[model samples]
Target: MSEEEFRDFDEELSEGDPEEGEGEVEVVEQELTKELAGECLSLLSRTGNGLSHAYVRLDLKNRKLTDIAAIQSFVHVRYVDVSGNYLEDISPLGELPQLLTLHADNNRLATINLKELQYLQVASFAQNKLTTTEGLSQPMLDRLNLSSNQITELSGLTETQLPCLTSLDLHGNKLTSTIGIHLPSLQKLYLASNTLTKLEGLEGLRQLTTLHVRENQITTLDGFAPSMEGLQYLNLRGNAVEVLSELTKLQCLPFLRGLVLAECPLCELDEYRVEVLILLRGLERLDKDEYTEDERADAEELSKQRAEEEAPENETVEHT
Candidate 1:
């Protein structure tokens, strides 16, 4: 054979034949396409299934969910988490009849219709462009996290609709004051990092356990309710509260444990300190950021004593 022909034959053998490589590449491409199509079809079928519980998460993040009509088929879905998507309007989610939890945070949702979610228990709409908080009717909701929104007024959540709401987070919002929020079952409230100048509309919640109102313009605790008998943790740090005497109403809360009062303009008043000691008799953690070494030692001693008291008892009996 000629040298050129032999060289071509050797190249063909070294490259494993072009036809074989082409066939292998085609098979791989076809398999990948089939797998992609199967996943899409499975998602579509799941949207069509009207089951009571559905979880379509961990895969749809950052994906554009433009097909709103696909959600109408899943009418029986109780919990739906469509967070981290590029969804514009979530009005189609209202079509679900049994939706209990809607976690649509970190989305481009400009508006939300809360009237459709009657069975919703936990709704997290954080990081949205919501200007107002209107049209919510779920009375059995337990937690509502609406932080990082543009809400100016809180008049939308009335007393009757949020009767069973336990935790509410409105941090980093534009709330100037706390009005029209008559939550009776509220246990923990997070109103930190807002534009609140005064604290109001939290008196009726006798079941309050934790109250976080730090980094606000609150100058007084005038509107603090004495009926909050169940409050345990209170974080009022970085406020303009001059007098700590207003916290005297907390004496009613026998379970008060932790109190954070750092950065507030407070003086060492003997009577007020005595009152705080009386009110927080059951307190295990008190952070003022100004505790001297001696004071910290005393606190540590008290904590050790309390721990000993809480420890299980060991008994010894002597026989006659």
Candidate 2:
């Protein structure tokens, strides 16, 4: 696919169905029947109190079904897997009061709004046609994965208040920037294979440890902020960062230990590794390669000599 693979339509979000293929074999839509539920429902977890029992899990994957109106009756189910289906709307699942985990990947879902599932913990809607993540408001959600979707922008994320969220994976989307996200409690964030040009609006993410913006259009570290104290890993491979001196801005990241810049323009320089090490002595690894003890000592010695040489320049300027 081309670089501008994921197309965007201004700022407006559209939930319309994707264009169908020519002469595509149509599969008849099927509803959730009691007999199918009986075959799919193998009580994975249960709790009993007198004559009452709570069902904890159900696997309804690859059922080729369209409607799942029967799950609302199974109120005790905590985990549900309805992936690989022809589901276009999953609003019926919003009626599930005790739902904890929901896997609805590889479906034809265009828009998802689980309607503030209070007890929902983990949700994955990967490989779907979701164009926006606007209405998914879960207070207790910890991990969310929306990979391989056509999501153009991240709206209503901060306004939703995901207090317990730690990991968010939006790999392979159409996002053009990181300006809309402002999650402070998030730790692991994946924005790989997007259309991002620069990184900003994420400086307040103090707890973030891993950030994957690889295969994007990022060309500079001018937006890097020192307030991001907890980030230790940043992947910037396959970007357009060319100026070797631009890496000097990376010194603001005091806690950064691993950085990936393998396919960038600066990686072609002969003194690339030594120059990067000289700038940021704290980095322990670079582009899938760990720094050896000998390389560290050499960098330290060169750094001292380089500082000494620049000392006379400062002294001359002072005298002037």
Candidate 3:
């Protein structure tokens, strides 16, 4: 063969080879260029809603999204929902600094690094394969739903750090004990369907309004302290609380309104009922039932006034 023809054939063979580093570099460059074009398109598509307002919702349910590198350009995202995806790691989402809400339930995420999400408010990691709860550093977070996971310990949550958290749902886990943890602002705490045998860590939560301690092996209420003065509702139903004697200790909570002792082994309501009534003089409800005549009358009067104000003028005239 001629020398020129031999050189052309060699060139063709090199271009056809798959293991060439030059070809790999060209492919990577194409991918990066396409990604940049997509980012430009995304930016152009966004309306002038606000400066700190960028929402990206990705529902890759049951899809094989192995790498989320495309989301690197969405640094201004405020909300992201990648629930039900096959994501094993969520490190890609760390690039978004302005994220507020994240819904990543029913995935294979074992751990999350949420240190960059400083503005995140609501986070749901339910039904994931998480064994340990860590790396959540958002100070303004209000709601957290981590139910149906394999979390065995509640040691990561301390009162001094998570002061802004109001609601926490840790149901269907393996938490056996809670010690040295205080949730001061927690209003509703759901620890049902867990392995907790005692309520020890809840003594210092003065602002706890609703506590669902049902379906546990709690036999006594001795862990409760009088400092829980703002407790309004208590649900010890489905427990082994045979005697209702320690309930008098809760009398200091003058705002205690509702008490759920159903399914307990209590056969008599003799003096305990009267004691509770006398102690919590402001008790207006119990087990989803209204209070006595006076409280019900007051509530009805307020409801009637609100109804009159909300009624349409034509409806009022027709009624008159």
Number of the top-ranking candidate, with lDDT as the measure: 2
TM-scores vs. true structure, each candidate: 0.67, 0.88, 0.69
Predicted candidate 3 versus true structure: per-residue lDDT over 21-107, tens digit per residue:
344322121122324323433222242355543334433443334456666676656566666555567776777776677887766
Q: What is the full ranking by TM-score, best candidate first? A: 2, 3, 1
| Tens-digit per-residue lDDT, 217-274, candidate 1 | 8887766666876777777777787775666656666776667666667535553433
The best candidate by TM-score is 2
- Model 1 poorest ten-residue lDDT run: 5-14
Better of 1 and 3 by lDDT: 1
Q: CA RMSD for every model?
A: 20.4, 6.4, 21.2
Model 2 lDDT per residue over 138-157, tens place: 89999998888898988767
- Roughly what TM-score does model 3 have, to 2 decimal places? 0.69
For model 1 the TM-score comes to 0.67
TM-score head-to-head 1 vs 3, winner: 3
Against the unseen true structure, what C-alpha lDDT does each candidate score? 0.63, 0.80, 0.62
Candidate 1 residue 24 Cα shift, in angstroms, is 46
